[model samples]
Each structure stands twice: as structure tokens, then as C-alpha cells.
Target: MSTSRFSSYQPFFFALVLAFGVFIGVMLGPIMGSKPTPTQARSTYTRMDSILAYIDNRYVDSINTDSLLDVMITNYLNDPATIDSFFKFLDPHSNYIHKEDLQGFNEDLEGNFDGIGIEFNILNDTILVVTALSGGPSEKLGIQSGDQIIRIDDTLVAGIGVTNQQVMSMLRGKKGTVVEVDIKRRGENELIPFRITRDVIPVHSVDVAYMIDDITGYIKVNKFSANTPYEFADAVIKLNSRGMKQLILDLRSNPGGYLQGAVSLADQFIPGKELIVYTEGRAVGRTEERSGKAGLFEQGKLIVLVNEGSASASEILAGALQDNHRATIVGRRSFGKGLVQEVYPLPDTSAVRLTIARYYTPSGKSIQRSYANGTDAYYDEYMQIVMNGDADSVNGRKA
Candidate 1:
């Protein structure tokens, strides 16, 4: 049986479906080391204190909360295992994506990003090719998903803890640059080397949304990007004229995107004054956003196909539509990502996307998955679900 901790994981996932096309809840850019604003500092310190206090007082066994929390933070950034296990127990949907982790997340969410264009994963400390870009250098050179990237130039990728960040740094170089990679596939025991020239990869956020039937228009939203809502609105307008009665909004693998974009889209469905979502933070006041008058849900039977991967703004849209009974949410429950991030200006012309507020659906559901032990435990639990095939039950309904 799922514990209350496990159950708490749902709200964060209400937004994501775990698609490789998915990224983090916050879109962060570069940021220089700068002191936090007074409000921001308070929020940070409060969060820090809360974690410390919990570790100090609530742990079943005696422990040092301050040191443990530090260790936990260090582990969260230094090791993915910390996040992998934490999510296993309490809010499995919460993600502990660091700044360096943004590349993969963006590539997944936007379908493409500036990179060398190779899909890789860690298997027993070896960088294995899950896949490579189609028509890209890796594929042209005969690299397959099962292939193991044993080396980068002369640097061995195995034995050492070569993280996804490290691999990305090694491979994703400036355009017109070249990266030499060595691989060993399942069939071949010998390491094969290839020099790949990097290039810009075009990302497709909107999957075809043409009329599948005279009545149903199928639009697959892979991820919510900057251009998603604009494209989505145009598609809906065209479909409306085409006599679409039933619209299948497929958010199956969508990770999420901009809040304004989601709210804009959701507003098209809900008429007015409807609470789509509300957030409260230490510095931020109760900020509530609702659908205005642009949504297309009022006209037809909207069936939003969701699963474990749909998250963030995706969850916001789904929750808003579902809470208002404007659409029939099919498939499975979403990745409940309720933590709203505030991207503050940093000294380095970058931004810090900090968790400022917890988002609540209209019915007072704190969609942000509980980060009870921070982000470490959150991710570990998610991995456990894969091993146990328990992802379907990630979100247990609360009475």
C-alpha cells in the first residue's frame, strides 16, 4: 500500500508525464553569485530552517539536522541518487534539477536545444547511447541507442562518475565545432570512435493537430514551449471552422512550459473569475490566475490525454480545466508539480528560478508535491516506481 508520503507525490506530477521531452519546472538562465533580495533571502532561509528542523526533530532516529540537511543538499546536487530515493517515499513528482541539468531538460521540453545532438544515459557508470539525433552526425556515423560511449577523446567515461552534466559539457560545444566520441555497442565489443561536428537542432513542440476525423481534431502537444499557446490557439481556430466537435488535446508526454502561456490557453476555456490556480509564498502575496475569455473548452467535449509525464504548466492547465469540469482528463493522473518558481535577476545577467510559492488548485489542493526531505528522496522514489511498475498509482486521490 502507498503511504501518505507516497500519496503526497501526486500534486507535483499533475504537470509531467516523464517524457524525455520534458524538462524542469523552472526555466533558469545564467546567474552570477549575488546576495539574495531581502524577501528572497527570507524565503531561502525559511526553507533551510524548515529542512533543518525537520531533520533535527522528526527523524525517527537521532541525527544532526544541520549537517544532514547540508549533506542532503550536497547529495541532491552532487548525486542524482539523493533525489531518486527521496521521491520514492514522499512526493515522487518533485524534481531536483540543478542549473547544469537544464540542458537535458530544455532539450526534452523543447524537443531540441543547442547541443551536439546525442541521446545518452548512464548504465553501470558507462555512458550508453539511448539514441542519437536522426539524420545527425551520430546516426550518420552508425551510433545506436544500445551503443556505449566508452570514451570522449582519450578521456574514459567509465569507472569515474561521469554525470549527464559532464557528458553534455563534453559533447555540446559551440556550433561548427567538433567532438570526438568513442562507443562500444552491444554487438561490438571493441570501442569505435567517431568525430562529430556540432550543429543547431530544430525542435518541434507542436505535434500535428489536424482533423483526425470530421468531428475530432487530434493535436499532440509534446511540450509547452514559448510558441505553444500561439500555435495551439491558431490550430483551435482553424479546427473550429472545420466543424470539430470533439477535440483530443493530447498532453501525454508534455512536461510543461511558461505559466502565462498555460493561463492564456486555459483562459480560452474558462469564461471569467474562475480560479485556475493560486500561489502563496513568503514574499509573494496570494497571486491568483484565472481563465479570461479565450479558451476553446466551452464548445466541445474536450478530452485531455494525460499520464505520469504531464507536468508544471501542463498540470496547471489540466487542473484548471478538470477543476472546472471543462474537460474530461483521461489516461492516468499527472506529475503533481505545484511549486511555483520565481526567476529573479542575478548579477551575471542570468536568473535564479527559486521555489517561491506552492500552487493550489481551485479546490485547495496543494499541487506541489511535498518536498518533505528536500529533492533527494523525491527522485529516488520515482526510480523505485519504475522498478516496481507502480508509476500508474503515483497519484492517489485524496479525500
Candidate 2:
């Protein structure tokens, strides 16, 4: 009888063990069978596996798409003109900067660079020196304006297919470096060769700042760059020390730069906690920037000058002061680039500047004209205005 009971309980014990095994499998199934992460999956394939497979399976006589595509992309990105067209497709102000161009871009924003310091223009395939920047290495070495670069070092560059890029590359260099150039002066029988030691050249956004009279001062901002606000502040302090009680801030033809610089500059004039500018986009929520910090010349009579060439951060500063009635806005209509751009650097050191937001004035005015007609048509709007006799108007109305 006991042996029979034991045999019957054996089936029950087997059933219990099976049930526990199934439950444990169900609990740990996801952890055991989960997909591997991207890093782990990449370990399974060698770097050249795809390229090798394409080479082996491709039926064409000769078509290296893998390497060809890389070369095409690199070439397109390297060419500034081509990359400019790519960005201009979306908007007028959007831009791309290759690694080679980053140095110049940084120098522009920083408002300083090490170079021989002469602005030149390639007119009729000849490099014409427009101006030997005052107090620069070139100017110090007696290099004058209207001089032509006939040769650079040993290369005969005159009348060659020498581009502006080549000329700049040959001239600009590290501090204490020397660049030898042959200048063709007017009425000179022979070319003049001079070795110019490169030095720090200041790129001034505040082109000129001085007291016009006892109480009146003038400051011209060529562009709103990273160093603009500090330069402006210093200029204002100097003017104030000279008994400047009224100020004229000129922004005519200013293309604009770092928005923070504009904000800081506007803050120097606008008083209290008033709204300066606001930005919003599809992915980004509405953000409002207000004026703070004790303004340097808040109590003085402020006049801001803007024109059709003034854009981006220029519009922001002007709009802020105009909306608050803090300053008198003079000159023609602004360029109206209310779009904000954010730059993202790629792994290869190249960068893409993308329009991420639309900024508005404190009074909820956009001032962004229109980009619906495409980039070409959009830029041509200025020509249309000029032809229509509307460009001469002040405050965007008939003069």
C-alpha cells in the first residue's frame, strides 16, 4: 500500500517542477533575449565589411559608390561657394563653415587676428590693396593704399588666375611671422619688394567713437560681434568722461553677430526690467529676454541709426530700444533678419549654421519681412525697393 502511494505522488512532484521551470523562464525571457545595443552590434562587423561586400557583389565594371560618395560630400563641404548655395536654399543668412574657414570666422567674431593687416580686393584679376589698416604691420612697413600685389614671395601672382582666397592665405599668418610681397605702386618703373612682419590686427566693430562736441558723442557699430559689447562699453565710458550727455549709436550696414552681444549692448541703454526680445519656434518654447544691469547711459538722449543693411542682432538691439521708446530710430528700413541661428559642429570640424528660432521685439513685432519667395527672390527685394524709390525713405515711410 505504501509503495502505491509513493508512485502516485511521483507525478505530482514532476508537475510541480515543470510549473516552476516555466514560470522562471517567463520571468527572465526578456533579459535573456533582448536586442544588443548599437555598440555591441558594431563589434560583430569589421569597419570595411560593407565596403568589401559592395565591391564583391557589385556587377558593374567600375563604380566605387562608397568612396565616390565620401569624396563628393567632402568636396561639396570644402567649397565655400557650393556650401553657401546649400544654406541659401533654406534662408539668406544660414551658412556653412568648413574647418579651413573656421580660423577666419573666429577672428571675425573675436575682432582680432594676427596678419600683415591690409584689406585687398581682386579687381580685374589683380590684387589691389584697398587700405593698409592704420597701425598694422603693413602700415608700419610703409605699405600704402592703392598698391597692387604683383608677386607674393617667389610666385608671380599678377595677372594670374589668383583668387582672393589665395591672396589672403599668402598674407595672413602667425604673429612675428614674415611675408614678403612685391608691390606695384603707381608711376613706379620696378616692383617694390618688402618683408612685413605680421602682428596683431584689431577688427573694430565700433569703427569710431568720439565726442562730437561738449555734450554730444557718436559711436558707429559696423557689426555686432563677440567683442562688440565690451568695445561699446569702453567707448561709452570714454565719451562720458569727455562730457558726452547725448549719444548717437550708428548701426548702418551692420550685418550683426552673436545675439548675446547685442543683448548686452542694448542693456547698456535700456533701463530696468523691460522686455528686450523674445524668441519662439516649433520645437522650442517661447523665451523672453529682458533688460537688466545698471545701464551706463540710460538717462542720456539716445539715437540709434539703422538701414536696410542692418540685420539679425542689429534688428534685435534696434527693436528693443525702439519698442521701449528708449531711443530714436533713424535711417531706412532694417534688413529684418529676425531669424536666430544656432551652429552645430560636426565630428570632422566642419559646422552647419541652422535657423532655429524667430525673434520678436518686446512689443510683439516681428520685423522679419518675408522669405516665402525663396532666397534669390528674397534678396532681390532690396533691389526692387531701390528701383521703386522706397529705399530712400526713413522710418520705412516716404522721406
Candidate 3:
């Protein structure tokens, strides 16, 4: 009777076990053989992804994804105060360049742009031409200094509260573009209508290089650019030909640019493989720059002038010269800006200028001032010198 009962339940038990096995196989098949898609393989889902997804699904109105992303990035990268606590630490100089502004920013560093080149000042609600740049379309068209711009193209600009940006927008265009302007000269009563063609205008870094006395030459460097080295060399040659035995490099109020330009300028004074500057960072290890070639004006009595406005590459050059004992640094103390920025281009043609390294002079001294109190305080401290009349003091020291 026991054997008979067992045989009767055996078929029912076998069927139940088979059903469970089928369910397990069905559940595990996909997991065992599945492969991640390209997007999944590239990056895991982040908080940003979650936020964007939530916004897409639950937001009240339609949103442009591209513009939204742009705004998010711009706000976070351009303004440190807007960032979260986790990402609050950012230097003032490290900034983001939008795609639209990238071209102009690059042109500034490259030392050239396509425009009717004329430096202008808005005075008494009128656009006054300070001076037409040399060899530019405006200068070639006989646009003189002190000429008042009455109109740009068809737009009446005079007495209209036109901004500097508006004037630049009106004057700058693609090469071969024509921009008409009406100018009122000091003597001439009639408005001089001139049609200027836009062309590549060279931005000169060396503002002026001339002999102050018989033996002393003066060179005012406005900023370091890609063309700075060549321009400086030319200036040196010109001064040398004119009997210059000593040099006064005026870097006062010069906001600096281009590390290479500063290094090259320092090389012009430092002799024979001596260290000019060295940089160290987490990503870009230790790197040293030294004088490698014969330099112009190397034998001269060199002097570099700096003020509170002189910074970045200006500081680098001054520090290099001072550390090498190659030049005497005169005037007020330099605006300490020894952080080295490296521009990284993004996929959208925008860029991020990140402070990648801190540069040191030959003596391994960093000229970067303390910014621990924040950027606002950092700038305010420098500005206080003027208010306290400390700027008038020799060597920026309070008497």
C-alpha cells in the first residue's frame, strides 16, 4: 500500500519542479547574455542625468535642451558663487569662454583681427576717435585722431549714448566687408563720409620703442600675445641701431597674456641656459624654461617697470629678470599673478581656462599673492594701496 501511494504522487512532483526550472531560466536569460549600449558603456548615469530626466518628464513648460545646458554650464563655470558647496572652490582667473566669444578672445591673443581698426573713446555722448591703428583700414582711409564719429553705416551714433561694444560691432566685420562712417573734423565744418573696408589689422604688443636719451631706450609693452616676441625683437633691433646701450621696459598697467611671450621676453635678458621660469602642477609635472639662444639687448642695463596693474605674464617676466639678477625691477610692487592657466577646448568649440600650475622664478619663489580671503578681498587689497596713497611710495612699501 505505501509503494502504490508514492508512485501516484511522483508525476505531480516532477511537473512542479520542471515549472520552477523554466521560471528561473526565463528570468536569468536576459541578464546572462545582455550587452550595454554605447551610451551606457561610455558613462554611468549621474546626478546631472537624473536632474535632466526629471526636468524633461515633470517640467511645466517646454525647454530648449541646448540652451538649458549652456546656461547650466555658464552659471557654474563662470560664477563660482553660484556653484554648490562641493564645487565652490574656484579661482577668479579660471574662466569659461563661450563659443561665440572664443573667436574674439583668440584674436586678441593672436594679435590680429578683421576690423576697421581704430581706438575710440566715448566722450560727452559722442564717439571720439583716439587714433586709427597704423596700417589699418581706418588709418589708410585717412581717419585721423580727434575726429568725432557722427554716424556708423546708416545708424546715427553721435549723441545717442552709443556704447563701446556697439561701436566695435559696427566697425568689425568679415574681411572685404565695407563699413561707412561720417566723421566731423576739428577744422572742417562738413561731415566727412568715408567707406572703410575691413581687413586684418595687426594688434601690436610693443606700443612704442624709442630712445629716451642718447644711450637709453624705452619700450612700452601693452600685453603679451603670440606676436609679442617678434614685435619685441624688432623693437630691440630698431633701438640697437639707434645707439641704445640701456633699456627701460615699461610694463606699468599692463595686464599680461601668453606665458610663451613672457618666457621669450625673459630669454632676451637672461644669458646662456639659465633658468628663467619653472612650472609645477598635478597634471603637468615640473617643467623648466631656460635661455637657449643668443638674445638681443642681453648686454644692456635692463630695467623692468611694474605697478599694481602689472600681472600674469608681466609678473613672470619681472620675476624671471629679478631672480636671474639680470634686470632691476623698478616702480611699485607687481600685481601678484603667478598661476599658469591652460586653455582646454571642448567639443562645442568653447574653452575652459583652468589654472593648471603655479609658476616660480629661478629662485623657486612664487609671485602669486594669497587669495584665501576670496577674489573680492584679493582685488580690494590691491585697490586699497591707491586709496591709502601707498601706491605713491617707492617699491610699494608703506613708510
* lDDT, residue 68, candidate 1: 57
Q: What lDDT would each prediction earn against the true structure?
A: 0.64, 0.74, 0.74
Query: lDDT, candidate 1, residue 252?
Result: 71
My TM-score estimates for the predictions, one after another, are 0.61, 0.66, 0.62
CA deviation > 4 Å runs, candidate 1: 1-113, 116-155, 173-198, 345-351, 385-399
Off by over 4 Å in 3: 1-88, 116-168, 174-200, 377-399
For model 3, how does the per-residue alpha-carbon lDDT over 190-259 read when each residue is reduced to its tens digit?
A: 9999999899887778888999999999999977999999999999999999999999999986678898
Measured by TM-score, the strongest candidate is: 2
- How do the candidates rank by TM-score, highest first? 2, 3, 1
Q: After superposition, how far is residue 128 of candidate 2 from its true place, in Å?
A: 7.7
Model 2 stretches astray by more than 4 angstroms:
1-85, 118-165, 176-197, 376-399
